[model samples]
Target: MSIQVAVNGYGTIGKRVADAVALQPDMELIGVGKTRPNHEAELAIENGYPLYAAIEDRIDLFDEAGLELAGTVEEMVEAADIVVDACPSGIGADNKSLYEAHDTPALYQGGEDADLVDVSFNARGNFDEATGADHVRVVSCNTTGLSRLLAPLQEEYGVEKARVTLVRRGGDPAQTGRGPINDILPNPVSLPSHHGPDVNTIFPDLAIDTLGLKVPATLMHTHSVNVTLESTPDADAVRELLDEQTRTFLIPEGAGIDGAGALKEFAMDRGRPRADIWENCIWSESVSVEGSDLYLFQAIHQESDVVPENVDAIRAVLGTADAAESIERTNGTMEIGF
Candidate 1:
């Protein structure tokens, strides 16, 4: 049976999810829900996806904008086999009762309170934890990057403890309300950033600490990470281990691979609009290991890295694909090497 999926809050994440589901043969995009009747609504309708209003009272927004409403959001929830809520952070949680009321499963994004869901997911790590779970929240972008990198290292080298300093963008590029606009916003400076605990949700047993500093850049988030391993492995061996992830790339020494900008250009030159999601560019030049400590600098395409993870979460929910299957399929379509 083809899985009927509906995307609620069809903005950045929702739009990507809708497109990804439409591409999967095992899934059918039955409908898409948007807060207002905007260009996304027209695009959804043009693509033949039935459009549902996000808010019941805002049904008039669609009508006023001349978009034909498919039905109420409640109706879409009842109709969908799975729902992806891409609404803002708090909204997804607030809407959870509706999904449960309809006996439908939902996949949530990073922003929601992680404890609200039965599982927190990053297809590579904690994927099995997501299986058979009713509600799953994808970890934050920085957390996703950290988990993906750490899991492999721990499996192969045994991690003792790890610390990460995150240089996060002030806001996503599409976002207007965010910025220090040419200023460096000191991290919580006093309190611990949420990432360390956020990672604990995925690895309940691992000892990890994270600090964050916000920057005015909207391109991507960069991390300076240090890991103390139980046993030390040479730099080359560590690089090889990380590359096994398929989504991770070790930028060559001579390549002018600077920051997120070059990484994006690399993906575009190869014809990928949202390449950063899958191609986590961990600088080969930045990789170094001494004694029992390992260090590296990596850049994550914040807006896009989670896109593929979202796709993977849908597959996990429907039991259509597993980690191995998804990794193989995505590797075939994406050029993840540097």
Candidate 2:
């Protein structure tokens, strides 16, 4: 059975999710819903996606802009087996009633409060947690990256404690409205930024603390991760374990990929659509183990890392496939590993 999927919000995350869903053999792209007749809306139509006006009042605006329409957001949601709410943070919460009214299952992004969803999902960490769930949040890019990394470690060696320092990008390349364009500022200046807590939504008992900062770069978010394991494994052993995971790309010394800029260039060099890097780019040279603790540096593509997780979450929520099969299918369809 091909699962019908509707993506509401045709922006950064939504656009990518729509394309990824279209790539899945077991899924059908029902359409996408947008608030206005922007370039993304035009792209949706050009790509042959049925474009639905997100707001009834905005239908005239789309007509005025000379863009074709597929009707209203309500029609799209009611027709789909599930809806992925890729709307801006907090906006998904406001639109929850629409999905609920249509009796459609919905997957929201990480910007939402934990209380808003039945479960917080990371395909590697807790794909089963989202199984049969009516509402699941795919988690933030940083949390998704952390979850993907820690899940393997915890499973292989048993994580005792984890600490991460996040150097986050201020905005995406197109997001000129965001600030700190010339400065690196402590984002919250508080102990344990929300990322650690967000991860707990997946691993309820894992001891992890996070610190965050905002940087001038927009290419990706970098993480300085320190994980204390119960068993002492050498750096090489850990590297082997990480490389075995499909969602992780360990940057080899020969790749000469020093940072997120080079990483994005490498994706473009490989002809990745939108230059999207869905895997966590872990610097192989940065992996080190001292005593029972492991340290590494990884860059998370904020715009794209969460894209595949959203696809896997679809099958998880619909109970269509197990984690391994779903991850492999999603990876194969999108070619996730480096």
Candidate 3:
């Protein structure tokens, strides 16, 4: 029997998770919960996904929109084996009670506080940490990218310390309300952004510091990564190692993929769904080692990177598969590699 999955929140991440879950051979997308009957809800229905009214009062609104809901969100949760809470920011924390009421495990996004769950998950960094947990949070986009890159480094050549400068997209392409429409600002303007501590949630002992900048573009997030390794390895070796990682897509030299815009274009040309690039696009030429210091530039597609992680977290919470098996299946099922 397939694992029955329910997605609560049919927005950016939620919709993507639902689509991914639908593609998983061992998982069944029971239904998706939506608070509004906006375009996404319509898209869900058009895609043949069963939609549920997330807010009881909003059922009338959905009806007004000429949309049919299978049931209430509570009813969907009750029937689900696992729920992916992709609600915005603090909303997931608020929905915890509902999931708990039915003894259904939930996976939350990074927007919530660290204490919201005992585990902040990245399939590459800490899939085992989420095994059988009641609530698991897939870390945020930048954190997810960092974790994916750092995991292999931490394993192959012990990371003495990691420092990253995140050139973040001010908003997702569809988030027209979000801004800095013409300016770049130091988001938080503080040293060691929350990402370092967030990373600690996964690799507790690893030392990492992150800085953030919000740029005007909505294409993707670019990371200027510097890590001090315990041992020195040539760039080629590091490239070869990262190349082996299923989720990290190393951009080869002279691929004409100069930046995020071109990368998005490349993804579109490859016929990627929603122009999503789930892998961390590392500049293969940027993989450099100066003695024990290594530096690289990588672009992260914030919108889709965590889609696979959420899928893996479902299996982890159920203890259904080990990290390797689950990751391989997810990558294969989703066609994750470049």
Q: Where does candidate 2 clash, by residue pair?
A: none
For model 2, residues 1-338, the per-residue Cα lDDT tens digits are 79999999999999999999999999999999999999999999999999999989989999999999989999999999999999999999999888889899999999998899999999999998898888899999999999999999999999999999999999999999887877989988988799999999999999999999999999999999999999999999999999999999999978889999899999999999999999999999999999998999999999999999999999999999999999999999998887
- Runs of candidate 3 with Cα error greater than 4 angstroms are none
For candidate 1, lDDT tens digit of each residue in 228-269?
999989999998898777778888889997888887788878
Residues 244-302, candidate 3: write the lDDT tens digits. 99999999899998999999999999999999999999999889999899999999998
lDDT of 2 at 171: 93
Model 2 ranges with Cα > 4 A deviation: none
Q: What CA root-mean-square deviation does each model show from the true structure?
A: 1.8, 0.8, 0.8
lDDT (Cα, 0-100) at 303 in candidate 2: 95
Total clashes for model 3: 0
* Alpha-carbon deviation at 19 in model 3, angstroms: 0.5
Best-to-worst TM-score order: 2, 3, 1
lDDT of each: 0.83, 0.95, 0.94
**What are the TM-scores, per candidate, against the unseen true structure?**
0.94, 0.99, 0.99
Q: Model 1 misses residue 253 by how many Å?
A: 1.7
Cα deviation of 210 in candidate 3 (Å)? 0.8
Worst 10 residues of 2 by lDDT: 179-188
